[model samples]
Target chain A: MAALNIEQIALDIASPLAEEPGALLPILHALQEHFAYIPTEVVPGVAQLLNLSRAEVHGVISFYDWFQAEPSGASTLYICRAESCQAMGSAAVEAAAKQHLGIDYHQTSDDGRITLQPIYCLGNCACSPAVMLDEKLYSRVSAESLVAMLDNLPERES
Target chain B: MSVRVYVPSDSTALSLGADDIARGLGEIDLDIEIIRNGSRGLCWLEPLLEIDSPEGRLGFANVTAKELSTLFSDGVPGSAHPRCLGLTEELPYLKQQRRLTSARIGLMKPCSLDDYRAQGGFTGLTKALEMSCEEIVACVTDSGLRGRGGAAFPTGIKWQTVLSAEGDKKYIVCNADEGDSGTYVDRLIMECDPYTLIEGIIIASLAVNADEGYIYCRAEYPLALERLQQAIELATDAGYLKHFKLQVRKAAGAYICGEETSLLESLEGKRGQVRFRPPLPAIEGLFGKPTVVNNVISLASIPGILAGGAASYQAYGSGRSRGTLTVQLAGNIKRGGLVEVPFGLSLRQLLEDFGGGTASGRPIKAVQAGGPLGAYIPPALFDTPLDYEAFKAIGAMVGHGGLVVFDDSADLGQMARFAMEFCAVESCGKCTPCRIGSVRGVEVIDRIHQGEQVEENRILLRDLCQTMIDGSLCALGGMAPFPVLSVMEHFPDEL
Candidate 1:
């Protein structure tokens, strides 16, 4: 992947919206929404704009699991692995996804289309075997349905 | 006519395909306004739906897009489906809750300022801004409010400490790093009623005379982080958070940072490790200045206390443990969700009445209240009222109002092992008793589980637990052994 122009992007987004007392979170959210991940190069710029140190900006970004500094794949998949999901055959679904994708947890697909991640719980114990694909959530997912769902995704060419 | 529909923003509701229902409804292109709200805690028939009419909010249960049109055609105020629990307010579980901090939850659109204001949002802050810092502290003291973060320290005294401390650069730190398993109340409050917490934090900052505040939330809650970020923006724009310089910081899944001192270190961009206290956080914290580190619920309760006045707040609960308790009912339970009740409710009532017993359709053997560090109580002790003193008498601490139930299938010995293992993984390695003791405790418990020198192993494990409890620096190491020891004492048959 080519290097991102983080400084330019930060400048475009920076304003009074980025400097409020609760500004750090919204600024971080906007940054992630626009860039998918908080760019390391823009850390200083964000810090300067918010009157926070680069360390503070980096610390806040790194502390929350939602903020990612690295580039992400096209889509993110969060498979539930909590006790409730575990009881309802999520383990089987997880195994199948791993086999089908041929990738480990937190790793992106070779074609950079999908990234698989593990989530503790989705609060859908009754449905069991839940998975979140991008912003959309799926429930009562069987191993068979998981594969079919993946295969149905729009194909991407390198 | 503006037709109103409600879909839950609760994680459990989303897990049960509420998102699909919402999306499906959105796709219909109808002349209706669909609002996503929080859970009403009726977990059995989740993805509960509500329709707003000129009269009142109509309720539905386990609703799907396929049934929406038929339900609309019926013209019923509430669902007649077998799953429907009738009027939501009339539900036994919801009716019993005190709901001080959670008053607005599941009732309003999460991001709508108008919805929040309608539910009496910012009223406490508006009232608080009229009082001096001393008056605020006195009000909290009069309310008899204590820390809900397990320690049960008096909230008023904590604020007074910070207020009395000699420092211009004091800080208020909100500990939103809810790492304890089976607890999600903080996440729920942060997501559904984000402005309440923000308002509470701002009030706290003002009382402590702090120019800046920070909310350190864990990384696991992506939805919560998004909502909190949005709330912060809205609050700041409205000049609420601007009244004091308050910020929200996110923790990168480090369980150890739930301990106040370690949380401070993580905020300073270091590894989330615990620090020794002679200088408790109230004296020197967050960049070597006095800081008030409190849990989310503790901070969130401040607005209600300020608005209601200390005496009115104090009038609800039993001796010492005053105000409402926001209990996160989770684990092997039929109706697991957040429920806030006054301090005097019994454990049995919370588990059986609100939680609806075991979720697995098995008999409940034990319950662990107050997070991982809390003691495991047998079913026989269920009648005990959930107050700090009552729990203390029974050798339990209400760490955070997390009640994790377990069915008969649960092995106490294995659970003990998990407690030790959790400590071993989360220990900041700052103290020997926690770092080294937890690993040894796990090994000893494993030996007992393997049936090797059972009595000897039991005695050794007990000794190890005592040592860790006494010698550890912070609650991380200090209270790690509580659950393990409690399980061993109460459920020897499982061993």
Candidate 2:
């Protein structure tokens, strides 16, 4: 199949949802899901298609922490920094992860394999200091356990 | 008889590795059918494997993948495997309380319509189907059921406003944006019993004369969102729901959106900044139409209230606080999980009897009742009951019924600072007091901690907190001072 254009992809994903009230958020979500993150290149096109100003679209994208402006790396690592995790010493877990991955929150590794982010709560408070590496949720993660989990992540498909 | 086994598929259970155990069971050559059910709220014992016997559900605690075959070979139910936790219902922690809103969690499949209907699933909706909107509203009002999402406002009163309000189109929105650190009750209901929520929303739509509804769940809870979306689709497909239209809208990581107005703003695909009151969401809510925005727990509890009469549901609790509360114990607690009890039960009982005290084996120095915005209660005041009025009487609100415990190892200064920092990070920038007071609050606490003008800083912190309390536009700014003040009152040395 010929490669689909990014503008076409944005239009194809957003057209059906544009009619819904407050359709921008849903459209952004669909675009992010297909592209792994919102593409800045499609911002102007999305604005034109949705009848929103480019600034308004950008403001919405920037307001929510989930809507990253660039394409994601191979995977994203989320470390819980809320009170429950702090009680169980998430600082240590976070430290170990940063040391292991050689990256901090919002920073991709030098080779671009992983992007780290700080999530407030994943509702896994029962298992304090929870971290979601890729799609898996690991509980009661000590520094050592988090490192092991991070290391176990499979290589990203090129 | 073919033996059946259940493994929880909730986030906590999955985090503790339930899927691997199920896969391990799947590999075994046995007639036993494996069912992926929601957590029984016995979180500490997950992945708690349950077997169906002639008696009831027998449980096994923390079963690993390797132990699956051995557990079955040792004769699962009657045989005394070391991992056996006995009949799950009889377990002292689960048996000592009520499970009104959470009755169906852990017992059945998370999204199975057949299982849901078989286990009295739409009974309340079926009953509600025959009632008038006025009668439905009256039943909720009589139930004395308040919102479980921190605010403790009367659910019936909020609905009454929307029901009576003159608007072109009314909407029912479920605030599933449960971002509080210690609370997961909303996520539990959505994940464990999605049908309950679906039924509850439909009933709400019926009572309010709303033909459209939305469940604005946080993107934080992917599993809950996925299940709720699937449940809505399933309910729609099965013709269990028709008159009302329902949809699950995903919230993009905004903690302030948990506030109903901010949530409405976010739902409109705008910045999740707080909107002013008087023209409450009930009057001019989503898209400026009359809307009823209820928390996940408050709405989810409706089906049971309707099916079992308001008084029967109101039989629990004392004073103004009626009905059972689903208290989620987090932080350093040993028996960390969800406990549904009456409102009058004290934090002492929940912390000791249900939670089994701190996991670190140290005496719990403090407990943050409610969420980040809630006050920190020292051990001296452990006897304070879980009533909304009772908590407020002692300068704390039972906000969302989440008690996050902290042992002796915790640094109150850091905890205090973090509370301010959390407010600062999530303040939505709508008002000045929260947006600026929080950052200054953190600096003042730091100065006090560093022994620089300690006395002056303490005074300044107190002054700032009072300003945030009195002047802020929304609760995010208004209630953020509770934790700061609690730290100052109880742990003077730290501040």
Top lDDT: which candidate number? 2
Can you give the lDDT of residue B6 in candidate 1? 86
**Cα lDDT of model 1 by residue, B79-175, tens digit:** 4455455667767778878889888888987877888889888888888889899988898888898888778899889889889988869999999
DockQ of 2: 0.80
Regions more than 4 Å wrong, model 1: A1-158, B27-31, B73-84
Q: List the lowest-lDDT window of 10 residues for candidate 2 chain B.
A: B74-83
Q: Scoring each candidate complex against the real one, what DockQ results?
A: 0.18, 0.80
Q: Number of the top candidate by TM-score?
A: 2
In model 2, which runs have C-alpha deviations exceeding 4 angstroms?
Answer: A1-4, B75-79
Tens-place lDDT digits, model 2, residues B1-495: 668999899998988879899888888877778999998888888888898877888888887888666677755545365666788999998999798899999889999999998989999998998999999999999999998888888999988999999987999999999998889989999999999989899999999999898899998888998998898888899996688889889999989999999999999989999999979999999999999999999998999999999999888898999999999999999999999998898889999999999999999999998888998899999998889898999999898888888999999889989989989989899899999999999999888888999888889999999999999999988998998899899998788
Instruction: Supply candidate 1's per-residue lDDT for B285.
Output: 83
Name the best candidate (by DockQ).
Answer: 2
Q: How well does candidate 1 reproduce the true complex, by DockQ?
A: 0.18
- Deviation (Å) of B240 in candidate 2: 2.4
Backbone clashes (count) for model 1: 5
Clashing pairs in 2: B150-B400
